[model samples]
Target: MSTVNILHMKQGDGEMSYAKNSTIQMRWMNMALPIVKNTIKEMLTIHLTSFEKLESFKIVDIGCGSGPNTLLFMSEIIDTFYNLSNQNNHQSPEISIVLNDLYKNDFNNIFNALPLFYEQLKEKYGHEFSQRCFISVVASSFYERLLPSKSLHFVHSSSSLHWLSQVPENLDNKGHIYMAKDCLPIVFDAYKNQFNKDFYSFLNKRSQEIFPKGKMILTLLGRSIPEPSSNDGCCLWELLAQSLLDMVSQGLVKKEDVDSFNLPFYTPYCDEVKEIVMKENSFDLDKIEVYMCNWDPNDDEDDDNNIFDKKKSGENIVKRIRVVSESMLVTHFGELPLDTVFKIFAERVANHLEMEKTKYTNLTICLKKK
Candidate 1:
């Protein structure tokens, strides 16, 4: 699909809510931010920063949800320079940053929170802090609108690339007879297409904008082993679909619609990503490593855990199977009267465990410009 068509398709999903008072989303963000921040920091230390002496730096956090990652890096750069000079009683280096996301992002909350974050830093570091640094919010898609390419020193994004403009065209679930077998391929093609279109544009654009030797550190959902049939091994998403199926049985919607209802998300395999990047010829594969990130806990520990353990082993199996379903449920059904829907979904998951088992693993990619 064309980028314009994809943007329009995303519009139909409704606006991405940016309300600060949002509670459930806040809970989810609270769980996600720290993990993402630490990972970015770790990647920077291991892959991006090679020399100690520094000069002016420009950094960007794409899909910078809420700005914690952006703030973390900025603080780290300043601190690194300060510590290096601390023993010598010298000056700190200067840095400028830009945070970008879709124009529809909740800039109100970001603007409100930024001044405070800015003040805290300025107070400790003195007036020079404000002079050398800048933080501005840019509104654009990662596949498009990032300012002056070769201008950035470091670019990072986490957990955001998997969403494409819309479901793949061939898989459109407007109606189908053999959805069970056809569903996986349709979903895969839609994701593959989105990556091809968006990332291709992303590479071509970045090639022109990024300066020689610049780097992009991207962490997103990817297939662990390139299973043409598996959906990033996300059994939860499948179960969530089953829940949609249940909803249909209860007269909520049509079965034909269910078959055509492809997920609006896609996770790329490591090799697929490498192919796109290598094909560009402007980015040399500095270091590409794919490791498994396990987000599931095996313990029966909290209120959420209680739900997982209370079921019979048979029921437990379904809950286990729906791990992907649970994630999908949380992704979309999180805010909806979760109280009862969660219970029904959990029960269905437990009952279905007899048929399948599921697990999820993420892929991380690190690259540099040619």
Candidate 2:
């Protein structure tokens, strides 16, 4: 499937909406905040001497998703610039923030929340500071150019970029939605090749848009191991495939349906990401750090309990997965078996978690445009 058509957060604020079930994503955002702050600080320092003469400072959040994280990031950037302006005894530059996502993204949700965002900004940094910042939404895929040449100062993305533009052509991974433990070597090569191509295009476009010495911070699902088939990266999809296969046995879904379905997703190792960045020759890789996050970071209390609560943990994990993937799944498989599939998926994930706590290795990389 083309990602532009299917890859969007669940729209609206319903129970199943991405807005409601995005705690894990929120955590990933929080984890990336330190890198964001440091980059902003460095940029300020590098350009401090010319602060008085500067006109506007442009920052973009690619794949900004819905309201919560986007608003939080905008607020942080505002705060950073506001403080710098005060310290230097110069007026803050007119700030332009562009939120970029696929055309299907619910940009209405973002525009609707602007009144409150402005109100909070005014409360925090006076009405004048709020007036200095301008926000706009750009609906387009990041694989291509979205901004003017050398027009951006800073770029940020979190929990995005793992999605390919589309499923690989002529995929033959039968009965699996993603790379499985039993997948042939060709299946792995197809996924890796697609990622390389998409990522190269992404870097190439961003290279033109970002100014010299501009900074970009990206956080995405990745693996610590060099192998592409690591469980930490592929387990969720494997479990989903199991759930669908279970339905097939009961005649709820066709075998061919399961065989043809493929997820346009890939998680790379930290080294793989660095290698591509170097090969692209557009950005200097400053740092790439991998953090292992629990499947349920909020389940701290359950960690100490003698008996693990599989049902509760399973439900939590399933909700996270469903919020992101449900739209694509329903689009392809129909909505008749959606609930049942997730129910079975929850059980499988819970059982696995009970035996051994699995963690997602998230990669945070900082780059500077040359």
Candidate 3:
């Protein structure tokens, strides 16, 4: 299925909405903020030390999912400039922040919150300063160019790029929604090839939109090793697959339905990312770092590695996955079996965690246009 049409986060701001279930993405956003702040400081010192020539500092947050985080980054950027100007006595430049996401994403929530957010900004930096900040939301696919040439200053994205434009054409990945330990080599190759193609297009298009020397910081699901079926890569999916198979045994779902499903996602190795940037030749790979997030987002105590409550941990993990994947699953599996399937999935996740703890590795890559 095409992600452009069929894929989206569960919409609205209710308990089950993506809005309420995005703590993991928010965590990554916080982790990447220091990098963003330092880059903004560097840009001020060199490129836009003075806004005499450049009137506005323009930024686009590609795949900026709707939620509390929608405006959090933008607010931080404004504060960065506000603080710098106060400390250095530099003139504050007008700022523009664009939020880009798939058309199916729920944008109304963002629209509703803008007025109050703007009001709060007015209190922080005064009315005139707030007036200089512009906010726009665009519904479009990032695989294609969604901005004018040489118009952007910086780009930021988190928890977005791992989704391919679509499921690879003619994939025969049966009995699994994603690459698993027993997945065939042919299936793995198809996924890798699709990621290469999609990422190349992404870079080529960004090269057209961003000004020379502009930078982008992207955070997405990734793997530490080259193997696609490794623990950090596919263990979560394998557990979910086990849940589906259990339902198959109960006749709750068709075996054929389970067999035909495959996700439009891929987590690449650091080497794979390096190779792609070199091949594209449009961006300089500045740095790549990996951070391990537990399958349970709430599990953050470094000294505590034990799962005291396996059932709660499993439920927490499934909530995160469900907010993001529910749309696609409903499109493919119908609504009747979703609750039951996910209940079983949570149980399987709990059982799996009892034996071993696994994490999702996120790769944060920094790139600058060459």
Candidate 4:
């Protein structure tokens, strides 16, 4: 029998183009993704510490955006061996890691960045570093990608799975009601439908490909409190979208186009995730927790503003947020003139968020293969 549990996975559709240019935005993610990676890594460490049976393992990183988290794991593995060597005078256990994500991701960027990470390792541990490291990047989707059965030991992804290739065809974002009550169900349903279809397929495929004792650690944007009617308490995605709409009135974009643009996709609460993962009955629940991400220190807890003022002092914060947010938007809205559109979008989001308090609520899960 297979045991399965869902904590939280998808938060919103992923935007791809964000990290391509701005080092500042990329740096911000460096802080965010690592925190997420460390949290999951601690979970994995705790689980591994109790396992009496140990062997060389293969690590698979899904949706390895920029490969930061993948490298982080590698760093952890190296630390594990180094600590062991210091204690018992033994070499680290041999491990191989593979990085996988959509073909469009900045693999070259990752490759270019590798020298720096490798240098850090070599500087710390000398020649022993290169001999133990095996890293490869695979460009493909989680469902259709090919891998040998029972070949992987650990699988991981962060902030990447929520994006569906496209928004559901039936979604209508321009409805008259703008309150949380009116907006909640439509988006949630779209997200739930997409995840059930794709994520189910992903799990079934993995069930065939991974060994019985392997494990997966996944962290995604989530809602700590269920939003049956509105998007409050959800991740910061909707706030980003509202920022984009602010550009329309400023001659940067058209209102009709903004209305037509729905967030790419996301999934529902933990139970919904469990329904999909449990299909093959091959996974065991280990840990599931929800935490918040991305915060504005100046926000007021009880105010709402519809228009973002791009001209405000410190509004430059949009540039940092824009790295990922605009990247995804440009990928989808490329036809629109970027300079004009982004100017309006930034100004609007700044103004709109001037009075609202928000945080990123995320779901983190760790599962052991049965």
Candidate 4, run of 10 with poorest lDDT? 1-10
For residues 1-370, could you state the per-residue lDDT of candidate 4 as single tens digits?
1211111121122323224214332333443455444543453356444222334445555566663544664576556556655554544544556666666676787788778877887788776745665667766666553477766555655565555555666777662112134465665566567767777766767677666766666665555555533343333445455555666656676677667666554634666666667775788776666664434423333457633333542245455555555655665567766555456545555555565544555565666678
lDDT (CA) per prediction: 0.51, 0.76, 0.76, 0.54
Q: How does each model score on TM-score? A: 0.70, 0.91, 0.92, 0.73
lDDT of 3 by residue, 111-146 (tens): 888999999999989998899888887777788777
Taking all chains together, the TM-score of candidate 4 against the true structure is 0.73
TM-score of 1: 0.70
List runs of model 4 lying over 4 Å from the truth.
1-55, 67-70, 175-181, 184-187, 228-236, 239-246, 297-317, 335-354
Between prediction 1 and prediction 2, which has the larger lDDT? Answer: 2
**What tens digits encode model 2's per-residue C-alpha lDDT throughout 1-370?**
0000001111121112222345877788778887777777776677333666667776666666665867776687678778888999998888777776666667788889989998998898898988987887766677777777876666776776677778888999998899877899999999999989988887898889777777678778898788877889898889999999999999999899889899888899888888899999999999987888878766764466645578888888898888888887777877547889999999999999888888889888888888
The local distance difference test score of model 3 is 0.76
lDDT of 1 by residue, 1-370 (tens): 0000001001111124122212322233344434434543443346444323345555555555553444554565555445554644644445555666666665576677778777877787777655666676666666664566346544554555555544556665433221233454765565577767766776777667665655565555566766644634445455556666666677755676556555555667778888988787788765555544322334233456354443354344444434323433445433444334445666665555444434345554556667
